[model samples]
Target: MKLTLKIWRQNGPEEKGEMVDYQVSDISEDMSFLEMIDVLNEGIIDGSIDDKGNYGPVAFDHDCREGICGMCSMYINGEAHGPGRGVTTCQLHMREFNDGETIYIEPWRSKAFPIVKDLVTDRSSFDRIMQAGGYVSVNTSGNTQDGNAIPIPKENADWAFDAATCIGCGACVASCKNSSAMLFVSAKVTQLSLLPQGDVERNRRVKNMVKQMDEEGFGNCTNTGACEVECPKGISLKNIARMNQEYLKASFTTE
Candidate 1:
């Protein structure tokens, strides 16, 4: 298969960036999107893909390509995580496109996610929000109590588990016109707030996480619901509502 990739390239965070086109041929339909890019990068480094040697290897992020790590983030053909639903960029296969298609690839375009190089963006803003409070205050080390001791409702447990599946990929921000991270932040907030294990710090967690999200320059949600549609894990927008409730309650209760 052959593809024309119009990929975004920037030397550094402060540098001007532009889309550069390159043709990749002999790609297997079974190859994961990253593997196809590996072929292109190999040619680029070896000076075989471009006779003029103008192209350097493109830099992108990927770890545990199984779609769990959420490190492989990309804006493909103007869509977050490509055309698939509930799939990360690494899980995207070459077969999703035609043999001779022209694909546009880009990094997550958000002020919070500054460009690093090529198609890679700095997503550490998510980490800072996580550090702000996405955690349980309780210890899980020596003599941890049995998980079943709390007797949480099945519905609540299931909801918490669903929200915990978020991988912090930042696709939600990329997909949102406002570049809001409410979905990601709320998923972390809801996963903990729904259960007894996370109750001790629930109020504080929501308050601090939301505060850090705003500090990072992430926009406010306008209720457009685009974040839910593009999230690789299908993290629900209901988490956002839950987070708002948590925040509202915290504002009155916490000092």
Candidate 2:
């Protein structure tokens, strides 16, 4: 199959960027989206078409392409992770698009996620937020009870697991017009709120993480629900509601 790709090109963080067109042919329908991009880059690196020797390879992020890394975070055709629900760009297949189609690919757009290059954005802000307090300081170094030994309700366990599926792709932030990171933050908060292991430092974790999220310059969630719609994990807006409740409760309670 032959396709047209309109991809964003940027030299560096300080440089201006724009969409540049390229053509790819003989693409296999079974190939993952990133594989198709690799084919495109191979052509560029091989000097297949020398437009004054300036047509270079596209730079995008992908590691552990099994959809767990969340590094393949490009916006495609106006949707985060491209035309799919509950799947990252690496999991997206070429067959999702028709033959001879035109695709627009752009990086995650947010104040917190400044573009490092073409399709790569700096997501270390997320790391800082987690560091602020996304952990349970419990001591499990010695012989510990088996996970099943503590009998949590099935509903609570399931919800916690659901919230844990978040890959921190920032799709939720890119899809929001306000570029809010609330869904990602809320997922982290809710996963801990549901489990007993995470109960010890619950108040401090929520307070510090939320404070760090705001400090990172991420916008507020305005109930647009776009974050939930675009999240590759389908992390629910209910997590955000739960986070708000957690924050308010943390306000009145003293540790």
Top TM-score hit: 1
User: What TM-score does prediction 1 earn?
Assistant: 0.96
Residues 1-255 of candidate 2 have per-residue lDDT tens digits of: 999899999989999998888889989999999999999998888877332326378889999999998889889999999998889999999989999999999999998999999999999999999999887776688876676889899998888999999999999999999989999999998898788888777888899999999999999989999999888888999999999999999988955
lDDT of 1 by residue, 87-201 (tens): 9999999989999999999999999999888788999999999999988777767878887887999999999999999999999999999999999999999898899888888
Best by lDDT: 1
lDDT of 2: 0.90
Q: What's the residue-level lDDT of 44 in candidate 2?
A: 88
Name every residue pair that clashes in candidate 2: none
lDDT of 1 at 120: 88
